[model samples]
Target: MKAARRALPLLAVLLAIGAGACANETHTVPAMPRPDEPVEGFDAHSPGEARIGATPADVMRMLAEDGKPSPTEHALTPEERRKLAAAFGALTPLHRRVLRERLHSISFLDGMPNNALTSPADANEPHRLFHITFRAGILRENLSEFLTQKERQCFDTAGSSRSVSIEAGTMDAIVYVLLHEATHVVDGGLRLTPGSAFTKSAWSDRTLIAPAFRDPLLARVKFRREGEVLPIDRAEAVYAALQRTPFVSLYASSNWSDDLAEAVAWYHLTERLGQPYRIVIRDQGNQVFAYEPMKSPVVRNRFDALSKFYEEPG
Candidate 1:
């Protein structure tokens, strides 16, 4: 019998458990005579040139080796591929540039338990070899509903009408997920956080942070605490505690890697794409609390560090 796969954490659905694990392991890459020689056969001259299709067998093997459930691959129809291409095209200039240089390909998998995952094609050369896999079901959903579903995973409703949801407004779910996952690719390629200026003030390393940025309550919730969840009754307290930290979402608090990805994605979503990222809680169909993360001064101050993503590559 195969070993049981562990439950995935919200927005922490990486192929590898954490950046620290990847950093500690050594992976072999094909010997190249020059740094400019193509790495692992990925040569997309532009983002639009990225190859899109069903998940390749090698990727499926990687997932199996990582102890992830083996999900069926989804072959894209012409129309589906076009829509995905359009969403890919909608990413920021920096995302496009970095992906064109580092991305191996983009693929879809059916029955994936998480929204999406980004994995390096060659662990030793993450910046040069990366592939992204998205759940196929998201193709049929919009941003608000998709995000609402993802956010709900952190709470146990306890069979009540009380609920928590995200209001990201109307946009293709793929666009937001792509923006988020591509940031992971860029961060891997550029080392935007984790030991860089972007994280110096708050993070000592990927999974360690300064005392001022830590919260006892937030530490006990969802991804922050492995396999643990706060009741829906604590949703307000959760968001309140989250506001005190620099993290923009509960998932971001999991580690510094996600911190950069979530911050950049939300900043791009609200500031550049003109979308709303409001978190609302409700009790028996009536609103209880709402939070617009971008409006928070504490969170907005962190945006200055994200300017590197927008700067023209030197």
Candidate 2:
């Protein structure tokens, strides 16, 4: 979702050492270092050119430090690497350039809890040296199924006839995920979204938007309010509220970074790639409501800013 924050154990040790230094002397204690700041000169990768491979040890360490499950690295076969290369090759020229400059590596891990995780390769340099880890499972999935599963996470459908599904066609799931994650890389490297050009009108900050853009109904959905879910019946109302905003998806309404990433990714998916990006809602196997996000004027107008992603980089 976002770059993982570096841990605080080292700060605790520094405080302990500072206290020990003042044990027998009558002197002021040294100022405690800020916990939020990154440790100076901390680099996640050793000196080398970036490559694709199994999850590296440094990445595993960071996940462990962050209290996440340390899933085993999936050994990539020649065919798998070829598939990944094709996905990378499908990216826009700007995305390719950004990744070449800032990406430390890309990895696939077995049993990853989420589809992917992107982290800074150098803690002190948040914009550069980034690495992305994807669940190996995604390589076996199609775009429609992958996106449907992701959208499904936001609702509780246990006893309802209503359900939502995406029709993104049969493109490799890797293409969509790479496009989304690469947008994040571009956002971090260029500072394109937060409090800048993309956010000026809609988003007021990272997690909050302007009053006009807010919807009380949409606010109760999963990403909008973390760990919360609405009944499957509420799917229609949620999407109706979404159609009124500049956001491309319900997840985009969650925060500013995703707002930019989803907008750019969907723009590329639907416009440039000519893939169908439709959201279908069904009630007892009967079609009820359908939304093609890019067709919404409000959402389409927002793409004027995202044109930067397609421009030839100077």
Candidate 3:
């Protein structure tokens, strides 16, 4: 018999589960190369001259460069700006390099799709100027709400005598979001995951062509590629789905690309950063079912494939 699939509530979508726009026409590309090629004498993971925060003038300049602004963007406040800079600074040097190299400017807007990495639409613009933006207020609100609720859920862990939910906070959420978005940038820059924008033109209209990952991680996870929309009704189904698949989180089920991003983020969080991550369900006010990817063999196997990309070669 097949294992039951998990279904997350709509609220979860507000946190970190969704796909960006993709072009109608499908474009094929080779899988990410093993041991990514390094730029001459440049540390691919460190922040160099690349700027972190953007002013209104800079936002306008970026809009003009794109030929037109969305009209939805607004100036970020001092607090929001500080949080963003700190988030960028906190990233592993390697992650910092990914954003520095792939993104042109990190802008703030009132609301947009969860967050997006935009490339110039014009063909004449030879330089590949990539701009990544997020909704400053909404992002913070969502992160707080999501983490707060998770704290109530019962979780099972190894090291501790009693089980408990991981303590997730604003900074924790910020770091996760940064790594998640950075993965998108790395996906485009290194052709790390299939179906992401690479060329100057394709960048404007992103596309997610299903990737045939050589490592068979997707297959092991039992990922379905029919469409981004998932049929989920009950909260219990979410844990059921996770129990069977190797996906690290509910958001990863959206697609293979998300799977990679979510997996990488959790891997770094739990394995590298020593943060806690897990899922659980209660019955009659008692803990009954729980799943922690870091402790599962199948889940760890999928994460093993992601380690190669983030870890430096000796």
Candidate 4:
């Protein structure tokens, strides 16, 4: 091992559950390797990055695409139709064409015959689906509104070259939300359950459960593909989706995997600094501390015991 890396302080995390309030737990984390490979096999469907936050026209084209699901047509006010057409009209024929092709080809999607938000249908069936439909400005508005003072502070002080333009904020926020949910999908996909490989363990008030993770990811953070135009987690991909797309609301936040996904995205986005992500820890006393996954890192928090999932390559 390199001496520079050896100089870095290690994070302490518990691999398994122990007694107490679930808060006072401490464990050890082996060093995270620098990810030099792409997560090519990850469940992330690269329907081109355009699906991040699509517009109305993009949405329509997506509806008609090959693997695309037929969206429900709500009775619109004359104003609604106008909004829809304008939103739908915003896309170039090329962009629409691309979206259609991707959605059709994607298999991880969880919707029925006519639902929108077409995800890939791989082993990682989406655990959380967030379809946010609102006026052009609402989603961004809510994000700006939803973030607590601490959240905002964290974003502002983050290390990544990732930028959050208020103007581009809506898609930026939702894309993170999507990635967050996808993280949950990845987490669930790797488990060994009945209908699925991943099953949720019943949460006893005293315990927290973690995902039984799969490879590449089971390694350390890495890029999608070398020389890829953008990282797998990018804000541009989310905002580029046109306005015609349906609005999915907050239910995406309800899942544990979703939160992890968002946290990962946040870390990747602000990953410019050597210190990557800062995960909030929920201790036995039911207290929350924003712990950087670097020095002084404590593994177990409110979510579950995810330390065992960390693997050091042989």
Q: Write the per-residue lDDT of candidate 3 for residues 91-198, one digit (tens) a residue.
A: 655566556654555655653333333332111223233345554543455343444343333222233333323333344365676777666556644666543222
Give one digit per residue, the lDDT tens place, for model 2 in 1-314: 22123332321100000000011001111222233444344343432123765565555654452455567888777767777887887888878777766677778877554566565655444334566778788888888988888787677889888889999999898888888878877776676764566687788766677788898887776665343668888889889998889888877777777777788788888898899999999998898999999999988777778877778957
TM-score of each: 0.84, 0.81, 0.58, 0.27
Pairs of colliding residues, candidate 2:
none
lDDT of each: 0.69, 0.68, 0.45, 0.26
Give the 10-residue window scoring lowest on summed lDDT in candidate 1: 19-28
Off by over 4 Å in 2: 1-50, 54-69, 125-127, 225-227
Give per-residue lDDT, candidate 2, residue 132: 78
Query: Model 1 TM-score?
Result: 0.84
Give every collision pair in model 1: none
Weakest 10 consecutive residues of candidate 2 by summed lDDT: 12-21
Better of 3 and 4 by TM-score: 3
Per-residue CA lDDT of model 4 for 138-234, tens digit only, reads: 1232233322221222122234434322211222233333333333323333321222211233111112223222122211211111111223233
Using TM-score, give the best candidate's number. 1
lDDT tens per residue, model 1, 1-314: 01113332221224321211111111112222123656755666755434774565554654453455577888877767777887887788889888887777777877555556676665455235667877788888888988777677678888778899899998888887788888877776665664676687668766666788877777776565343556888889999988887888877777777778788888988998899989999998899999888898888888898887787767
Predictions: Cα RMSD each: 5.6, 10.5, 11.4, 20.3
Query: Which portions of model 3 miss their true places by more than 4 Å?
Result: 1-71, 113-129, 142-144, 147-172, 195-233, 282-288, 311-314
